[model samples]
Target: MKSWRTMSICLLTLFLTILMGCSFSQESGEATGSSIILEFSEIETITDAGVQLAYDDVHEVKKIDNSFMVYKKTASDSHLYLGSVRDKQLTEYGFVGEETYIQDFTKNEESLFGRPMTLITGICGANCVENYLFEQVDGQPQLILKLSGHVLVADLNEDGEKEVVMMQGSPQIEIHVYKRIGDQIMKVNLNEEIGLTNSVTYNSQTNVFEMIINNETKQYRYDTDSDSLISL
Candidate 1:
């Protein structure tokens, strides 16, 4: 009878040990899955040269973050450079491109692919502008998507995700819609051209996208399940 009692106690001890081991492993796995969140500072123009400039003839110095900066030249034929701040000086690390007449530099209020994005607007031609959407990957800015002409960024379907709507044309105004799906910004085919004369905007009061085409107002609602726009 004593032998049986001893054996039962041994089995109970072994079971408790296994249970504690599994609990420790589950907690460790949760810690490994955690990630770091990046925060960006307000967009500030570089007025003083306290921080050394990247270019001798700089048109503008746009501070994207505490570490990352953008420098543009003063000439008509100029390029944009992704820079870094160190020891009160700006150093060029990534070359954006030439003939990039930067008009606006700002951060998107909406997150893309569960991450923040930066939007850079540049002149493509007369009465034309291109929107360059960039995401930070491995500590470097990477262009994920580009939209031309009159563009609007909004949560069209109110699905907690924003979509890009662009009114493009000179010959004829055609509205184009783009969404970020699985790390790719794909054009959502409306299957028909929605012409616009003035501009496109998201009416938060009504929760719909509206535009004035041919001096008349038209509205559209984004269908999340169908992945298309519904005319209203």
Candidate 2:
């Protein structure tokens, strides 16, 4: 009886240890699986020498956690950049080494520039004061794309289910894709980029996508498979 009890206790401990190890592995995989590389152009109201007010549009790359890299130019006309240090440790998660890294700038700072800084970014361009998608109006997610924009309701991946594509939502001049989940309309940020043309058309015969964005740039396409944009 004593031997049987000891064996049972040992088995239980081993089983619990295996379960904990598997749980940790699953959590780590989730973080690695859906990690995205966010890239976009951001506008900053840069004040330069002689009291010059200029909007410097800089490209940026970052992670989902908001850690990022900003590109800049200085007075010496030399190239400059900023990013996290790889040799240093990350303060957020306390994981050894920084998950995010920055590259050092090689240019001299222009004294006249009012502290080259970031002014955050919008979904569209500077012309779009606010992105309706990011804002919650009247308790609903903003569906604000350009009023005269056309949406693509074609199947982009050749899959049975079609995807919704919209023209330049913001900083990047890439085609925007979207999927519908119930009543809300969501922007599919990252996907296979097909360039930044204002229009995209499908060819049933050739089975190729065509660019027809020259005229009537305001028109938006609705997905025929789900018809979510209209209801969106």
Candidate 3:
């Protein structure tokens, strides 16, 4: 009986030791996964001065975070750079061709998944504007969304998360709305009764997206429960 008890105690100790080892490995992996190391430059030298008459002329340095910075010039057909402060590497994110320039770049106050985002606009053609939404994922700059025209991010349906609204085509008759579903972005279906119009507006009173066509109004409210839009 004494021998059996001693063996049982030894087995219990071995099991506990293995379990603790597994737990420690998992914790270490989680910590390492949370921190992402990026390969960036450590110098101010930039390639493709980008339509600038003068080489190495950069202005308007904006700091997005401790690691990322954006710099651009105000001259016509200028370039924009997204650089890493820690690494000192610069990437030209703005337009470069002739008859084009960096229009505007804005950093939204809201964040998703503990990562901040920036909206950038550049003119590519006579009537074409390229809109890009950049987010930091795993400590690196990521281009999450690119659109033909400009985009607006707002809680159009008064939901907790904001939705993306994009106006496509020349007359802006084709308005598209995208919402976040699970880990993907999906387009929201509009009510069939809603007519096609370029005069789309958000109605705060009803918490719905509205459009006015030929003096007639059509409203569509997003049903969070159904993940669809209901005509109001």
Best by lDDT: 1
Q: Compare candidates 2 and 3 on TM-score and give the better one.
A: 3
True-vs-predicted CA distance for residue 80, candidate 1, Å: 6.0
Tens-place lDDT per residue, model 1, 1-232, is 9999999999999999999999996654331222111121222233322344644445545666665666665545466655556565565444444454444544444475456887666554565665656677797555566565666776767778776767677654555667766655567423143322444555555767565544666666777665545667
Superposed model 2: Cα runs more than 4 Å off: 33-129, 132-178, 187-232
| Count of clashes in candidate 1 | 0
Best by TM-score: 3
What would the per-residue lDDT of candidate 3 be over residues 40-79, giving only the tens digit for each residue? Answer: 1222222432222222455544566665455665654244
RMSD of 3: 18.2
- Rank by TM-score (best first): 3, 1, 2
Q: List the residue pairs that clash in candidate 1.
A: none
Order of quality (lDDT): 1, 3, 2
Q: What is the clash count for each candidate, in the order shown? A: 0, 13, 1
Q: Give the backbone clash total of model 2.
A: 13
- TM-score preference between candidates 1 and 2, better one: 1
Q: Each model's TM-score, in the order given?
A: 0.49, 0.25, 0.50
For candidate 3, the lDDT comes to: 0.53
